[model samples]
Every structure is written in C-alpha cells, then in structure tokens.
Target: MEKSTNLSTCENVMTCPIRPIGSGNEHCPYDWLAVYDGRDEHSPLIGKFCGLGKFPFSIIGTSQYMYVEFVTSPAGPLLNTGFHFNVGNWPGHVETAGIKHGVCDWLLSSDSLKDSSASEGIFLSIAHWYPPNTSCSYHIKGHVGEIVRLYFPSFRINRIESPILKYEGDCGESLTIYDSDHADPARIIKTFCDTFSRPMEKVDFVSTSPSLYVQFDSKTGSYSGSSLYYWAHYDFFNNTRFGDPVPNTLCDEVMYAWKHPGGRLRSPLNSLIFKRTGGSDVRCQYKFVTDRRLYARAIIEVNSVSFKELPYNSNACTRCHEERVDKLVIWEERDKYQNNLACFCDNIPRAVRVISSADQMNLEMIVQGQHAITSYFKNPNPLFEATYEFAHGPLCGPITLGPSPDGELVFPYKKALAMVSGPMAPPEHHYRREKCIWELKVAAQRDLWLNLEKARFADRSCDSAKIEVYLAGRLEPRFVVCPENISLARDLPILTTAELGATGADQEPLPVLIQYTGDGQPGRNIFRLVWTELFHLPRNPDGSLAASLLQDGGCDFRCPGDTEVCIPKHLLCNGIPNCPNVTHTSTLSQLTRHIEWNLEQLGLLHHAGDYQQLVLHDESPEICLKRDLSELPYGKLSLIALGLCLMFALLFAILRRMCRSSSLHQGRHHLQEDY
Candidate 1:
C-alpha cells in the first residue's frame, strides 16, 4: 500500500545511502543509533553503538507494543510461544516461558542477510512462543521479507500519527514508517563514542517482518512486575526477595486460538508451532500449501505473552477511605469563600469574600516524595491541579502541560512512594543558613521499590494501580508494602550509620504505584523529595502543629531537619510556585510584562501588593497603550481590539433598550386608558 506522512524535519548525522533506523538496509534516519547487540542475556551488552553487525534488519516503524521472535531448530522438541525484547533503560531484557532454547535460540542465521540472496537480509530467530508455552507462529506470504531492529521512536510515543494512516487496499493493510517521513533513519545515524553521554529522548523497537506494515490491533501498557523488565537489577542474598516469593519463576508459552480475524481462515485443529529459529527471516513461508485464501487469512500471532501485577500501596499512601488523619498535615486547604485563609489578613470584606461556594475544589492534597517516581494507572482526570486565589477575584489554574512557550516556570513533578519515611526518629539539627534557597525535586516524576529478586504477576492484565493521598498522615501501618517502616523492621534497623555512613544514609526504596500488566508480573513506582524545608513546623494553640515560617510578623519560626535558617519569604503557602504570598502582585512577578488596569476595572485590586504586582497581573489594560494598532503585529492587536469592541457594544445596547422600554411604559400609564 502506498502511504505518506508530513513529518517535521530535525537534525541527524550525514546520510550513507539513506538507511532506516534499523532498516537492515540503506537510508539514514534522523535519530542516531545508541546501542546494538546479539549477546546472551547472562551478560548484558553495554557499550556505545559505533555501528556493528550492519544491524542486518532495518527497523522502519514501531507500535505501542511489539513482540520479539525466537524460533526452535529442527532438533528441538518444544513448542513455540511468547517472547520479550528489553530495550535500553526501559522494560529491557528477554525471558523464556517455553521449552529450553539454547544455542539454536535465535531465528536470524548468519547467512540470512548475505548480499547474495534475493531476500537481501539476514535470517533471524522466530520470536513466537510454542510447545511449553503454546503453538503460535508467524507465516510470511507474498514477496516476504523481514526487518529486525530497534526503532529510535516507538509507535506509542508518536500516538499522534496513528489516525493519519489507515487500510486503503481492499485487504486490511497496515503502514510502516519507511523514514522520518521527510528524511532517512540509517543514513543520518551517528555513532556515539561515549556511552555516558547518549541522548535519552529517543526510543527503540525491534521487528521480524520486512514489510512496512506490521499489524498491532490491540496494545497494552508495558510489563511492570518484572524487575527483569524495569531495566534496574539488584544483588540479593536469597534468590527470592523483593516483597513476596515467586512460585514458578517462569510459565509455558502456550495459547489456544479458536478464531482467526480474516473470514477466509479455519481454526487450527491442533496446536501450530512454526520452526521459528535457525536464523534467516525464520517465520514460516506460506504458499497457501495449495494456494488457498485461508493461508492468506493469517495475521501475526504472539505467544507466551506475560503480564505484571499491581499494588494499592495503601500502606504508604493516605486517601479518603483510609485516613492517616491527625498524623501530619503536609498539604493545606482553604475555603473558597475566603481568599485570606492562606493570607495573614485579619478581616477580609464580606462584599468581596475570598471563599465562594461557586467552585468545586477536588484539589485537596500536597505531598513530598523521597526519590524518582512513576505514575502507573491513575484513572482521574485533571491528574494534577493547583488553585491560587488572589486577594483579587482571579484564580490561576496550575500551569498546563505541553510545550511551554514562556518556558516551565514551576518545576514539573512526578508522584510515587519510596522508603525514607517510616518509624524513624526525626533528625537532630537543621542545616545551618547556607542560602535562603531550598529546592524540591518536582521534575524527576517517580519513586521506586528497588532490590527485588523474584516478580510474580498478581492482578495482572488490564489492571494497574496508583497511590494518591489526602492532607493527613497516619499512625497505623501501611499495607503489604516494604517501606522504611516495614521493610527495615525486618533486617534494616540493625544496619547503622557507621555501616552506611559513606553511603548517604542507607535509605531503602518503596513501591509507589504499579501500571497495567498480566497475572505474572506486578509494577511498583514512587516519588522523591529533593528539598523542602522552608515551611516551619509551628506549635498550634491546641498543642497541634501548623506549617509556618512567620510568627508575630517576623520570620523566626523553627525549621525542620537539615533546614536551620530559611528566608521568611521562601516559606509561603505550602511551598508551591515559590511564591511567598497567594496574591495578585506576587503571581505577576513571575511573568515578563504586566497590565494592572484590568484588575482595577474588575474591582479586584485589593491584593495588588504594590504598584509592581498591579502591572504584572494585567498585560491587557482598560486603556490603550502607546503602540499603534496598525504598527503592531495584527495577530496580537486584533485580539484585544475585538474584545474591547464587543464589551462596549454589549453595554451600549443594554442601556439603550432599557431607556426606550421605560419611557413607553411611563407614557401609557400616565395617560390612563380611555376605555
């Protein structure tokens, strides 16, 4: 099928006859290759990709999820089934669920891609799982060719491109990204001499079919339960560590296919395990056996497909149902009727009440994480929300995600659970006044449960879980998770500061969240706190505690661990947006320009702080600026002009209509009806 796309051009290396990223052919792509290998998993191949093995298979495109092929030799007795391909720092590694696949494990043979053949590519192992797993095989028909290699950008990352292509041929066809739409993948490929300096924005994928189109009808989130999949590994005393022990480390790769998608096909009478490996584009070649359309009905089949598990982390997280109330109020709450709640003002006018009943604030939380975090399956919309109501009437929503033209002023953050906070004595002394500055790690995004040994998928399949919480901290123990409070109580507390003094406090990681997976593997993630010490713990009148850095109009409130001295201005309102006060002037200081007139017109200038804040909050004013409308860019001037004209026209018409109606009614009533 002929297809094309409008791809944005970016820089890449010089083209060498234009190789696809993993094209197995010639055509340079925009992104450069970072790593390539054909080594056994027992020893991971980690090095800079200067270019090796010709890659033999050019990876032209990728889907949200793809399969890895492993075929058996004629000498093999096991059936074929599912496969795995761990790429880079992602869910990276290959595992087995079928019968033993040793030296003859791969289907891509040495001679598969020799320059002499018409197929013109190497023969690789058939990746499908069979026998011990299940009988499923890929049957390549027509001018069959296979392309095997990782992609720079996985199809899932480019979800925007999905609808742009569809099946045009009468047969349900698929489209493969031949190149960067405008450029080649391989030719632009650059060789990174250093491994530590590799660019991380790109993605990778592998394929077995040489066809541009490999059908991916349904896709699921990547596997999580498997530490073998997380791209991180640990050294453990026992083989079965990380939370719970796994019964059978692996499963057989067997599946039963009752119906085929193409109407022209018959169900398999018995299990079908194609001899996938022995190299050379190893998928079975179908000549229709006798040239029937049923053989043509075959689509790519996946075997030994394993999944991960999910955890509620109810132990570590506090929500409405399970309140960890009264322990600690890390986040603050305010009534919509009173904008002065976060402010120290004694009396706010009732006419311009800060708290209003007109808005619903689902945003009722704030948290501090221990380390890098990940978000699994959180089925909530407006996933992140923050509201700042100025003494003025305007409320600014949290910064919207996507391309930020003004650049990201507030730090981007991720959410998860980690090990640092359980059953431990608080630190003795806060840090001495270094700088008035304190920065928290809101940019990295996730937390982790590290040093796991065995992973068993429980509640796998389409189910994933997250850890969201309320303002309260709990005294009760967390559920099933091995946090500092739980995991350490076992063998952790025994280890001391002397033992780990050089190792930065020996903090154990905790599980924050888990994404979707199958019954065999489960996922866990967490959040991190870079630094958050500005808010002082104040002694409330009732012997309770409140977050404060100001006392009696001074900034002498006591600070927390490793935070001895903090500038009072830095400890404002829950320590977000780095604004000391929740008002109009403070918010505007973060912007480039201002227009204070708009606030005055709205009767909302009470919180302008000073004249400076007034200007920042309103870039569009009630009166005209010095610049001429015609001289300024049309796009900018037209918008403001249109808004003003519309406002004025609306007011005039309302007043005019009222006067005429009133006059007519007065005349009729005064005259009295003759009848």
Candidate 2:
C-alpha cells in the first residue's frame, strides 16, 4: 500500500503463525511484512517484522509517502494464520485558519464572528494522538465593557506516571488559563491536569478583563489508548450587573451602604459557573461602609448558600475542621478582633439573618479545594447570595438629659421599646438581659436630687429588674434599688450630688448616670424618676454652719438691705458689687424674720434663737465691723489696723512739709516779719 501525507502510522498487527525465525535482524526471514518511506521496492526500508508472536507494534513515518508490503513463504505450514496490519495518516495539527501569531497561536474575536449572531464558537485539539513536545495557545478577545466566558465540553489528556528516576520538567500535559491576554503567574485564573484516574467533569472559566488566554502543552507523545485532547467553547457578552470593582484587587468589590441602603449581594459572577484556582483557597470580601451615622448597625439576610460539603463530627457552622469545604463568613469590619458573627457552609435550608453590632460589616466568600480536576468539574458553582440593609439597633440610650435643671427620666424609652414590640419583633429570649442608661447634668456648683416616683414590674416580684445611680467618673453606684428593697429606699433620704461628694469646680455640670438593667419586656418593666437642681451649702468641720459675716440662716450670705435678692457665696468679697445698700440695716429685722422662717421650714428651728441674736445685735455698722474683724484669723485684723495708722501719720507729715515750702517761696521781708 502507498499513501501521501506528512505523517503515517502502521499499528494493530495480529499474531501470525509461521516458520520460526532465528534472532535479531534475521528473525523474520520468512513470511515477513516490510514498511518503507516510499511507494516502490527501491525506497528506504524503515522496518521489517514477522514472527510467531504479535511483536511488530506501531510504526510511524514522517515522509510524503508510506509503503507497506506483505509476503509469505510458499512452503509455510497450512495451519498458519496470516498476519494482519492497519495503516493510516496520523492526526495533524489543529486548523491554522484562525491562527494570528506564532506557529500554533490562534486568535478569536467577537467582532470577527459577528456573522454568527451569537458571537460564540468552539475549537478542538487534534482528533486522535497529539504531537510530542508541542504547545498551543488560544487568545479570546472581546470589545470594551464585554467579558468572555469559556466552557469545556470534552477533555482528556495523558497523565504522566511517577518514574523511578526523577527528571526536570512539568506534567506530561496541562491546560492553563489566564484572566488577561498575557500569561502572567499572578493573572492565571486556573490550571488543569489529568491526574485523576477517572474522567474529568465539565468546567467553566470567566475573564475579569476583556481578553482571556488559554494554553495547552504536551511534554510527551500520546500512545494508542491515551488521546491528549480537549474541546472548548467560548462566548463574549456584556456583564453590567457586576458590582463596582474595588481598586488594587483581583475580584473584590465595594457596596456603598449609603447609596444602596437595601440591596442584594452575591459572589463574583454569581450567574456563571466558576471553579476556584488551584494551590490556595479563593477569598472575596464584600465591604459595606460609608453613611455609618445614618444607622446603628447593619443586617444581612442570607437567601441561599451552596458549597462543597465536608464531613465532620460536629456542627460545621460553629467549628469547621475540614479545610477543603467552602465557607461564608460574616463579620463587622470595625471590630478589632474580627469576630465572625456567623459562618455558613455546605447547603443552607432556610434564610438566616445576621445582625452586626457595629455600623459597618463584611461578607467574605471562601472557595476551597477546587483545583483538583475532579473537584473543578463537580463543584463549578460554589457561591452565596444575601441581602443587606442599614438598620437601627434595639438597644437604648447613652442619652444626655441636661440644660433644664429638673426633668423626668423613664426607662425602656418609648420609641426604642416600640420597635421591638410587634409581631415581627425578635424572640422574647433576646430580652433576657437588657440595659438602658441616662445621664443627668446641672449647672456648675449646683447639686442634683433624685427621687423615684414609680417602680413597677410585670412579675410584681421585680427579681429580674434593678436600678442604679452613679456619679460621674465613678464606677461604683451611689445607690441601688430593687423591689425587694423598696421599703428601705422609700425611707432613705433623697439622693443628692452634694451628699454623693459630686460638688466642686472640677465636677461642674454635676453628671449623674441612671442605669436600669432588666428583662426589657415592653410595658412590663417600667420606671419613672424626677431630678431637681439644688443650692450647695458649705458646712464647717465641726458639723455647724461655716462662719458668715452676715449670719442669715437661710442664705449663705444675704445683701443687707435687699430682702428679695439672695447673694451667692462667690459674689461676696468679689470686686464687682452685685448687692445694693451693703451698709444699711433697714432690712436686718426682715432678714432675721426670713432666716427664722427658712430655719423652721428646714426643721432646724432649734438653732433659731442663735441666728436671731446674731442678726439683731450685729445690725449696727460698728458692731458689724467688730464682728467681721473678729472673724479673721492669724492676727490679720491687728496687721490691718497698724498699717492704716502708719498710712495716716505719713500723709499728715507730707502735708505739713508742703505748707512750709509754700511759705518760704513768699517774699523774704514778709517771712522775716512773720519769724
């Protein structure tokens, strides 16, 4: 037989029964078949074979024509089974019509394939056996704003078995894909090898950019049973629905919480089939931020989740021992510890809501162990879908109540409590432990009074409720009250800032914190309290009132003639005169009467006689002056008196000297007559 082709192969020879041949080159002396590079007998002989065993394997010729001849000895045994052989042209390189650059590089473009209307096509490797030490690359291009997707219909390649002696090279065959036109290591999307004993499943690939590069490489030739080949289809289309990509990242994206307050979030290319790259797990973080002030927290509701299932002895959501299973981790990005609020894996049955404690939150999708050929095909679409929204939290107050000296503070703030009261409210168990705080403040140097007007509970026992009052900058509560101690609390005096030691320049705006901890059941647990700003009275170390120049019992210091105006202690002795008629005694009797009245109201009438005597006898200026001087310590009054006497004597001496100078300046005659 003669054939014209670049390459030819002769294989599948059947066993032949013939006279036994000797050995070596002369083994097939009788009934032998010969293969030649040319059609005629004079052509170069490639190989000659014939024997009792099926020994002549496959023969390949790389010439334009291949010739084979078969002959048998006339005296061969009658029981001999004639030899059989098959010859044909080997499979050639892939069609070169689409090649654009290099010998085996092909370029496919959506614009060029516009006539097909679908903008899609398929290509294949050699039909049968592939050439040894060969490489082929395919470049897929799309227009701006368009993305390319590639799918494999059929794939089979020879897997190189480990040899006893190691060598330097890659696998016997491999298929690599890049996200971009260039085959940079960092841009590689995935790589596939025929390492599994069974057949590989179908797979899909997507390009983040407009172009995708695919390369198939073979390090060794294929034998009879193994055909190193594949069939792939590609399409180009617009993908406008993909979220805005994050800068300096491969597949991450940012969802602005402000612009899209409530919307859906999905894994990258949610609608397409994709496999995680080999070697490492694929992680994509969707960050939610901005407009944190508009909401107290973020809520994410997972609609569906699909991932590769992993075997475990315990619950996978709490603890995942398997490294190969995929996971959807939800957390608050603002949390320094990165505590995961919820972790979901495998298949989730019902929708679950994850509420973040902070304003900003993150959802991370992790795809693991998809690099293996079997896994690549089996787990093509491992992804999750969720909806998110910014929402107000259920907790109440860090609220500040101030400027107005007195106001009522109610626990379980009406508005916040209403939010958790309806049919859609959270389960009752969520209110097992709840806390609410309110801060009360007053002007500088003023004391605050707190009185509990009402304390009621649904259970009536109040075992789950307690109220605490704390001074500013103090951790310990000044007073704690509960239903069990209600009688004692009622008997106790009203709580005051002065009594709690929260009075001074440093403690201005005297802040008092009222905190309530309870089950937080709406309307079931409630309380109301009132606060009042009071004047701070100064006391002496002996438990009596401090010595005041004007001993008006009610007022710390009262103006002499103004019964209606009460002067604060700070105003006394200050350079600016705030009181009228400071030297008058007309209002002394009225002031004393007022003092006596205030003392009676304060339940201190036992000291009324002493206060009456102090105001009545000290009304005269001379007596007032003596009493003021007597009040000074460390001999201050004596020093003042001595300094005043010296000042008067010095002034008199200066005046006398000036008069004598004036007389000397007069006419000399008049001065002599005077002398």
**Which candidate gets the maximum lDDT versus the true structure?**
2
Worst 10 residues of 1 by lDDT: 431-440
Off by over 4 Å in 1: 1-252, 255-559, 563-653, 661-675
| Model 2 RMSD in angstroms | 18.7
lDDT of each: 0.23, 0.58
Off by over 4 Å in 2: 1-206, 213-242, 247-251, 258-260, 270-279, 293-296, 311-326, 333-335, 346-349, 367-382, 391-675
Q: lDDT (0-100) at residue 587 of candidate 1?
A: 32
- Write down the TM-score of every candidate: 0.14, 0.33
> How displaced is residue 598 in candidate 2, in Å?
26
Best by TM-score: 2
Report RMSD (Å) for each prediction in the order shown.
Answer: 35.1, 18.7
lDDT string for model 2 (393-416, tens) is 244433567735346777756666
